[model samples]
Target: MPVSRRDFLKMAGLGLVGSGLPATPLKQIARNVTTDNAASMLYDATKCVGCRACQVACKQRSGLPAEPDAQGLYETPRDLSANTWTMIKLAKENSEISFVKNQCMHCLEPACVSVCPVVALEKLESGPVIYHPERCIGCRYCMAACPFGIPKSQWEENLPLIQKCDFCADRLAKGEAPACGEACPTGALIYGTRGEMLGKAHARLASDKNYIQDVYGESEVGGTSMLYIAGVGFDALGFPRLKDDPLTAITWPYMKAVPAVIAVMASLSTAIYFRTHRDKGKQNGEEASDGSKD
Candidate 1:
């Protein structure tokens, strides 16, 4: 869904090509040591009742306006957008049903950060992948590079920018939980340190026989600040199956070499331009000299 003018204004109030080279070694990526203590949230889908309180809270906290449907009657967003950062989705499996929350996964080795040429997207030591709008150039590489399809553009605005969850960095800094987590009345969403969240998820999986025995975002794409567990298959909830390896491991060297490649191309172009222009100037000079002799 497209964002409204009011939503755009509210957000205003508040807020890459690779070169040919060997891929960077995975061991050298240097995972942040603070990730263990970084703020994280665990979403237990089994406990969710599709209340949408979290969604409403997110909109209020982010100062985003309601986005209506195509009919313009109800504020029903089908997926994440520049206006709607976090949302609730439903998944059905067999005779059971579950509610799934969709938002930024905030990957530890974020492909968006790796692909962004301007460093507009940054992964913080505290686990939030924050965006610097002033630094963004509207390349939308982050939109395409995100495995979860989280980042979205403000298509309705005259000057559009990307938007997504920041894990409520301001609240984190103030020693508070995210608005969405705090709004969940059912205890479906639990907030804690990444280490603590992971441990809790593991404990629940071991204790409860109903859980799928898998923790989404625990290791996918080298882990994420947001974790999830459901009784149904993750695929049913629209979770993509991914390897533990971070995507940056493969994209780093090429991204790192982009400046060098651009420099070489610029030099070649300059050389060709100067060489052709100089020859043309010399020919013009000789022609003038011959005309004078005549």
Candidate 2:
């Protein structure tokens, strides 16, 4: 039997029931790790001189290869990729230029962690979004779920994997700061506890009238480990103005009804099957009566 458009949509919505993620937004499932003791990174655009030392340090520490542009002599990359975990993205507004460091936000309630079918992506208690490639099936669902678009796939490799900055989990475990934080000479990138970083970000904004009133990443997507304090507008600096609520909360209600959706689809499928069978039986009966009458 042919399926109607409405039935197709019902089946599609039903697929969410077995999608490996919870239907309801379980409070403690992914949100148990709070920022109270979590390590965090703070980027102050006002203090950044755009030296790109942090960029070099990320490659050196991770042992990732450099990605040169069309002119192979330059290692300048426009955005995050498989090789470049972190890069200084330039934001231009006429003559004045601002530098924004793009990396994993490491969200407190990370959407990647919530959506990963294989549990490959995890949010550490130390405030880093780490990936386990061995567990990863290269699904790329994490890439779609992430609001910051931080994860990059190693598409060129024979045995490819997705890569992103883990906030230097190795260094953090050893009680040292991340390579990018260590390499920042102007104190632009600071590594510390999440609470302490938030305090500093707020303090700078309060002390300096020149700084923008808003603190990027403080409450974006229910807050992130990485925070930003910039003098220029966040939009002008290419920062996305996002709602404070986690994406999970926004979509969970519909997700919770997936079973019902699936039930409706199953019933519809059965109805279609029986109806076609009945119609075929009636046609056979009509043909037999006509032959008997002749």
Candidate 3:
């Protein structure tokens, strides 16, 4: 009536052996309407004057409310928040000051898109990572997945949504640039195709020997639509130390394996339940046969 270790091993083998096959290649869903053209934003920190006008512009365009101070004054946020989709953070090093605008990097292979269980975060062909709140179950998995910590949650409301910069997708649909790009006065933030932006970033670095040799986001997290050129080191400008691999590439294999693991677990559980029940039934039938013989 007792099951041996070998039986357990055999059952486990039946449940899991040959079940560790690789996942099928994910279907290539066209993310953007325009395949040939990719939307991108270029941020040259050397030219940024720390005006924070883009932050204001984002709020104005998005219909977001201004954050109020204790004194009820409308003070601009120092970091991206639920109310502020974009912000300018100040960094000082070697007696020099630079303003680093913080917003969504919008990676070509976005981790958020890979990790979202409900398909709430989507990578658009227009090169923005957009969040659909109606589909969101208010889980903050996207926040944990993002290397830049871009997506913020609106915790004040009973029903909240994950908020982040969408690269102004609506404006792009109307053939207009994003509000942040339009608000940048010194041409620090430029909007163009990803290929063109990379070229410009390299040209600026080459022209000015004073500029940092590296272009942030060109290769970081498997390339981002939003690129940055800084006079100072990128670390001084609050750029995260990201892996060279695409964020999604680092996470997708594990995510894809989860369903298989779940299926195996379910099958093993059912097998164990039926085996136990069948043994119990046999024991009961044997006891009744013995009583009849007596």
Span of 10 residues, lowest total lDDT, candidate 2: 24-33
Tell how far residue 258 is off in model 1, in angstroms: 6.5
Clashing pairs in 3: 31-125, 32-125
Candidate 1's displacement at residue 48, Å, is 0.6
lDDT of 1 at 269: 99
TM-scores for the candidates:
0.78, 0.77, 0.78
Can you write out model 1's per-residue Cα lDDT over 216-294, one digit (the tens) per residue? 9888878888999999999899998786768776666666879988999999999998887877977788779777755
Which residue pairs in candidate 1 collide? none
Q: Each prediction's Cα lDDT score? A: 0.87, 0.83, 0.81
Report the alpha-carbon TM-score of model 1 versus the true structure.
0.78
Candidate 2 lDDT by residue in tens digits, 210-272: 888877887887888899998778888887777666777646657676997799899999999
Best by lDDT: 1
Tens-place lDDT per residue, model 3, 1-294, is 143433444555565644333223333333342522689989999899988889889989999998877787767575788888888888887888888888998888888888889999898877778888789997799899788888889989888899999889989988899999999999999999887888899999999998889989877767788999988888888888775556564356567789877998999999998887887977788789778755
User: Where does candidate 1 have its weakest 10-residue lDDT segment?
Assistant: 15-24
TM-score of predicted structure 2: 0.77
